[model samples]
Target chain A: MTSALSAEGLHTYYGKSHILHGVSLEVAEGRITALLGRNGAGKTTTLRSLMGLTQAREGKITIFGEDTTRWPTFRIAAHGVGYVPEGRRIFANLSVEENLKVPLERGGPWTIERIYKLFPRLAERKQNRGRQLSGGEQEMLSIARALLLNPRLLILDEPSQGLAPLIVREVFRIVQQMKAEGISVLLVEQNARMSLEIADDAYVLDDGAVVYSGTARELAADDARVRALAGASAEEWTLT
Target chain B: MMTQLLLFNVTNGLIIGAFYVLMALGLSLILNLSNVINFAHGGFLVIGGYIAYTITPYIGFWGALLLAPPLTAIIGLAVERVLIRPLYGRDPLYSLLLTFGLAFMIEDGTRFIWGPQGKPVTIPAFLAQPLSNDLFFITGYRLFMVVVVMIAVALLFLLLRYTRLGVRIRAGTLDLETVAALGINVGMLRSLNFAVGIFLAGLSGVLAAGQLGLEPTMGTGLLMPSFIAIIVGGIGSLPGTLIGGLLIGVASGVTAVFFPAASEAVIYVMMAVILLTRPRGLFGEEGMMS
Candidate 1:
C-alpha cells in the first residue's frame, strides 16, 4: 500500500525540553494506523509535528507525496489533513451548529446535514453551546467538525480521553468508517486495545521513539509487547 | 426648565457615548482576536481626524468622511503586517509596550505635522443647523454623529453575524488553533481584523473632529473611556462593549445635571462598582480575564 503520510526522523521540542526524538512513521492510503503509548509518550507531539502546529527541528514530512514539514497548520490542513486535538478544544461560546460551521467547507461528501445524521445527539442539541455538551457529545462534535474539512487524511489525538466505554466504541466506529471511505487515518491514543482492534497497522511509541511498527493483528496478539511498550494493562490489552 | 436642562445634558452624554462605542468596539475586536492592547488606537483616531481635516478643503466633508477611514485602514494594515505580525505569540507585555511607544510617536508625529494647534473639521452647512428652537442642544451635527454611529454599529454587527469572514473572526477569537486546523489562515484573519478595528477608529476621528475639534492630545482624553467601556461592557464580548459605551456616556451625562464636577468621575465610579460586583463587567462571561 502506498503511504498517505510519511515522516522521517522527526525531532520536536517545547521551549527547552525535547518531546519527540528522531521518530518516524507512515500511514498507508485508505488504512487506519494507530500510534499507542502511555501519557507523555510523544504521540500527540508526533501528530502536532505532522500537522505543523509544532515544527520538528530535524525531519522531513510528506503528505500525499508533497513536502509539508515547513507548512503552517492552515496550509497543511488545506492540503486535506484534519486534526482533532486532545482536550476536545471546542469553542465553548459557539453553539453545536456554529461549531460545525467553524471548519472551512472543502468540497466533499460530508455536510452539516450528514454530520448531524451521524451524531443524532448533536442534532438534538444543535442550539446548545459547546460548553454545555457532555464529554461524549463534545467528542462527537469535535470529530464531526474535523469531518467537515473533507480531509483525505484524518489525525486524531486521544479521542477517547474522558469518554465512557460505549462512547469509546462509537468513536472507534467512526475511525473504522473513515478508513472504509478511502481516507487514511493516524490515530494517537492511550486506549491501545480499542484502537489496535480497528487499526490495520500499529506503531508503539515509547519515550519519543517508535519501539514497534507492524501489523495490528501481530501487535494485538503479542500481549507481552503491548503491555511493555504501550503501557496497557493485562485487562486493557485482553479482549473485552 | 430643570428637566429640559437634564435632557440636554443626557443627549450630549449619549452623543459622547456613541463616540465611545465606536472606539471601544474597534479596540475590543483587536483585543479579542489578536490579544493586542493597542495603546496607539487613540493615535490612529487622531491620524484619521487629521487626514480628514487635511483633505476636507480639497474633497469636501462628505468626501473626507468617505476617503479618510479606508486610507487609515491601509496604514493600519501596513502596521499590522510589518510591526505587529512578528509580535504575536510572544508575551502580551511586548505588544503593550510597543503600542504604548507607538502612541507617543503618533502624537508627536501629528504635532510635528499639524503644529500643535486645534483645528476644526467643517461640516456641511445643513448639518451645522439646530433641529428646532426647543431642543437647541440637539444640533444637526450632533444628531448626525449619533446617526452615523448607529449606522456604523449596525453594519459592524451585520458583518459579524452574516459574513464568512465574521464567523471565522469570532471562532478565531474563541479558539484560533482549531480554526487554523480547519484550513482558515489565522494570520491573515488577524490582519484583516486589525484593519477593521482601525477603520472604526479612523471613522471616529473623522466624526469627532467635526464635533470636538482636533488637537494632538485629543485622542489621549478619549482613550481611557474606551478602555473603561470595554471593562464595563466585558472584555471579550462586542455587544458588552456596545452597552458599556452607552452606559458610561449616559451615566456621565446624567451626573452632569446635578453635580457638574462629578460628571467625569461617574464613569470611574460605575466601573469600580461593576468590577467589585461583576468583575467581568455586565455581559462578560464568568472566569473571563481571570
Candidate 2:
C-alpha cells in the first residue's frame, strides 16, 4: 500500500542554524505513526516543512504518492493534510461554530454535524467565543476544525501537551477512533508510552535525525531506550 | 436661536463624521487584515473623486458615483498585485515606504492629469436645495451623503457578518496562517481586502466631491482625521471605528459652536485622551496597539 505521507533527506533550517539534517520517514495508510523526540528534536519542524509552512530548504515531500515538495501550505491542506499546530492556534475572537466554518472544504464525511456528534462538548459551546472555552475544549475545537477539512492525513503536534491527564486520555481516544475510520495520523507527542499504546508504528527522533523505527510493541519492550530517547515520564501512561 | 445654531453645527459635524467613517472604515479593514497602513489610501480617494469629476459630464453625478469606486478598486487591485504583494511577510517598513512613495506619485499623477485646480462637482438640482428653513444647514446633498454612508456601513457590516468571503477575511485578520492552513488562498484574500479598502476611500471621494469639491490635496486634508477615527475607534474593531469617527465628528461640531478656532484641535484632543486613558482607543482589542 502507498504511504499516506513520506519525506526523504529533509533538510530544514532556521536562519543559519540547521534543524533537520537528512531526516526521512514514512506514515503508512490508515495507521498511527508517533514521532517521538525530546525538546528541539525537530518534530514540529518536520510537520511544518511537510505542510510547507516553514518552506524546507532541501527535501522531497510526497502526499499520497504525489510530489508536494514545492507546494504552499494551503495547497498542502487542499491535498487532504490537516495540521493542528503545537499551540492549537484557535481564532480566539471567533465562536465555536464560526471556527468550524472557517475551513473551505465541505465535500467530505466530516461535516460540522458529525464533528459536533464526535465532540458533544463542542456543540454545547457552539456559540461561545474560542477564548471563553477551557483548554480541553479549545483542543477539541482545534481538532474538530481540522476534521472539517476532511483530510486524509491529520498531523497533530503534541495534542496531549498542557492538558490534564484525563483530558489527554479523552483526546487520545479520539485519535484512536480516527485511525479506526481509516485516516492516517502523524502524531508528535511527549507522552511516549501513551502514544505507543495506540500507535501502529513509532520513530524516535534525536537532533533532527530518526534514531529508531519499529513496531510500537517493540519500542514499548525496550524501557531504557524509550526513556533515554523520549524523556516521557512513566506517570503519563499510568492513568490507563 | 442658540438651540438652532447648535443643531446646525451638530448636523455639520455628522456630515463630516460620516465622511471620516467612510474613509476610516476602509483604512481599518486593510489595516486589520494586511497589517499595512496604506498611505496611498488618500491617493485612491483623490483618484475616485477625479474619476467622478471626469465621468460626471457624460454619465451624470449618480452614475459617476456608482461607477467611480469600482474603477478605483480595479486600479487598487492592480496596484496590490504589482507593488504590494511582493512586500508581504517583509518588514512593514518596506510596505510603508512603498505606499508612502505611491501616495506622492498618485497625488502628482492626479494633479498632472486633472490639473492643479479645485473642480466643482455638480450635484442633482433637487439635492442642492435646503431640506427646510428650520434646518437650513441640512441640504439635500448633505442628507444624501449621510444616508449613503449609513447604507454602505450597514452593508459592510452585513457582508462581514454573513458572507463566506467576509468570514474568511475576518478570520484571516485574526489568524492568517491558520486561515491559509484551512486551504484559503491568503494572497487573493489580501488583494481583495486592499481593493475593498480602496473602494471605501473611492466612495468617500465621490461623496466628498459633491460637498467639498475635488482637488489634488482634498484627500490628504481628510487623511489625518480618518486615521484618528481608526485610532480612536480601536485598531482592530470595525464598530469601534464607526463610533470613533462619529464621536470626533460631533466633538468637532460642538467645539465649533463655542470656540470656532479649535474645531480641528478638538479631535486630536479626544484622540489623546482616549489614548491616555484606554490606549486601545474606544474599541481597540487588548494588545493590538504597541
Maximum-TM-score candidate: 2
DockQ of 1: 0.58
Q: Residue A87 lDDT in model 2? A: 86
lDDT of candidate 2 over B122-185, digit per residue (tens): 9999999999988888999999999999999999888887677787888888899999998888
Q: Estimate each model's TM-score.
A: 0.95, 0.96
How much does candidate 2 score in TM-score?
0.96
Per candidate, chain B TM-score? 0.97, 0.97
Model 2 lDDT tens row, A79-110: 89888989899988877888888897747899
> What is model 2's DockQ versus the real complex?
0.57
DockQ of each: 0.58, 0.57
